[model samples]
Target: MTEPEGSEPAQDLSDQDIFAVLDSDHRALLELADRAATTGGADELAVHCEQLVMLAVRHFVAEEQYLFPLMRQHLPDGDRSVHRLSDAHRHLESELRRLEDVERSPQAVGPILADVRARLVDHVESLSQAFASLRGEIDPAEAQRLGDDVLGVEQLAPTRPRLDHSDSPALNKLVSLVEGYVDRIRDAYTHRGVERDER
Candidate 1:
């Protein structure tokens, strides 16, 4: 994924704190949103949307599993903030599903895409504010430890949306593993086909 202009180079999550990792994901998502907004064709728009969905699912899963719980523990009003964020997540997920169908008719996707972008921008801003508050209350070491925990959660997170298993981390991880295998097989097939065509 491309880093946003003026952003720092992408680094391994192990090398950065939780804020940095989340910021990176937010920037990448914004970039995808911009691309989706400007895409000319249905195919191109659909590709951007798909990338957005995958990034969003993984990002949310990591946050829900690691970051938010920590926030709830550290921040005074974290419970309310986290609840609001969770509601936004559900709304965004629903929009993502609609986007999949809207992409099939490119003309119909513009408004929905705009809505998604707006919601994402708002969500990112809220998260940044919450993290800033969190950082003030915790030591750097604790923040770094939380970052490591987030990295671990991300490792097992699914790239695709798990609508039915939203509340079950185990199920989501299993589905993600299966999805990863399928994606690898599909990618290999496509690569081989391209190579044969070139030959």
Candidate 2:
């Protein structure tokens, strides 16, 4: 996984601590989506929408690679719980893709972003409850390790959502790597989430 320049390692963080990252990111994305929905100017809307989507991409990937699997392994009726959460993620991604397509159209984008925000809120609540349950069951040392892994994987996660993915671990890793590389290249070229003034 690629690390940001001058970044320090995750310092003895527990799984509960890792959930803080998710909470912060969840707030950021919802705030961005809210801005996208309310902003009048198309350019401003596009900027917020792109940022929301990028944040969601990384957050979702980190959870899928680390948090969700832990839930499936540790929580009661874990498989079914994870399936519901994963399906919610897929639906959110689909809505985000639509938001991307109509980014320049304020009327169309507003409703889509609103829907995305609602879905995100619901998903976050569900995941939070699952994690709370898992926290009591999982070992402290293992949770710490998973926390570090979640942070590490997020740095290398794709900045764009990919719909066509398999459940196979090997294939998922390969797809994540390839997509992350391509998305980084595209973001570099287009300055995807960079503010217009900075660009």
Candidate 3:
């Protein structure tokens, strides 16, 4: 059966379910940050960080504009927490911009990523705690509406997400590189019986 298009649909997450996505990413980012901190970063570390910045910028924009308001209606304290998260987004944007500016040197990338990583860690911690406290206050249905809005966002990670051998080996190589990360994340968080359905 096809899943529901909204949050209430099969595997569609309620507020906590939506937060779980962010929480998972939060942990992944920490692992990436840890690697960057301990060993010198691999060449693609910066590239991956840029991808993360883009992903997060999109995710946060959608969340703040749509998701948080749902919570605000249900929970009186949500407005304040949302504001705090907005401030965190501003800070994160600044850090992302800084990361974007330094292209060549790992030296330049490391310290800035470290700073941003620290802030993200703290932001996730604070948001998690606050949201947990207020989760009981949110209506499941409204949260689903907010999640549906996220599903309706009008962009893709790639305009043409298809994979073909029509181009250079570079394209296939890049796909594999990303799939590797996906594999790690799935192994870390998903069960063994899960299927990989790119479509």
Candidate 4:
């Protein structure tokens, strides 16, 4: 399958299927989690957690926007799996938010970060398997197209969680647009997700 005309190639992510793209993101997140765990200072740990949270917000939005809906339509047990995974996503978001809020106190944040890491590990594994099954059920070209879409949307996705937003596609898209804009502003002012070099 060919990429859309005039769309910039997505680094090494071009031509990957949705599963591959998400797996790449999952690896990055897990590595960041490990780094955050090893950090000596509370402030450094807080920065790492902020970065993790921002990455996760992009990752989850990509999944909800493309992955879950595809699962529901393609996999035999997809509907049930989506429901369970959706719940898990909410729980993971809450854990990340807690980690973000308490990062100033490393003692308090350590356990939370650990929980987030564990949950993320399981979540990524589940998605990998589910999407593998899904990939088998769908066309290769369509899968690549969805992967390209995920990469595209993530560029405009929110940098923070909006716990109040529902999972419906149309509504979620609208919310994401607004939240993405607001989050960009907030991240700019607070430097929530900007790396030290960028700030």
Of the candidates shown, which would achieve the greatest TM-score relative to the real structure?
A: 4
The residue-by-residue lDDT of candidate 3 on 71-162, one tens digit each, is 56656676687767767767777777676567636777778888988887887788676567555765666555545545443122211112
Alpha-carbon runs more than 4 Å astray in model 2:
1-16
lDDT of 2 by residue, 1-199 (tens): 2212123443333344556556656766766676777778777778778888888888888777777677777877888987787788889999989888873787788678779989988987887787688778877777767767666776677888787756554666678888988898999899997778888
Q: In candidate 1, what are the lDDT values of residues 55-77, reduced to their tens digit?
A: 77778877876677777888889
Misplaced by over 4 Å in model 4 are 1-11
- The ten-residue window of minimal lDDT in model 1 covers 190-199
TM-score of candidate 4 against the unseen true structure:
0.90
Best by lDDT: 4
Which is the winner by TM-score between candidate 1 and candidate 3?
Answer: 1
Error of 2 at 138 (Å): 2.3
What tens digits encode model 4's per-residue C-alpha lDDT throughout 138-184?
88898899889998888788888668757697777788888988888
The lDDT values for all models are 0.71, 0.74, 0.52, 0.80
**lDDT of prediction 1:** 0.71
Candidate 4 backbone collisions, by pair = none
Q: How many residue pairs clash in each candidate?
A: 0, 0, 0, 0
Q: What's each prediction's TM-score?
A: 0.77, 0.86, 0.60, 0.90
lDDT of 4: 0.80
For model 3, the stretches where C-alpha displacement exceeds 4 angstroms are 1-16, 35-42, 151-199
- For candidate 1, list the clashing residue pairs, or say none: none
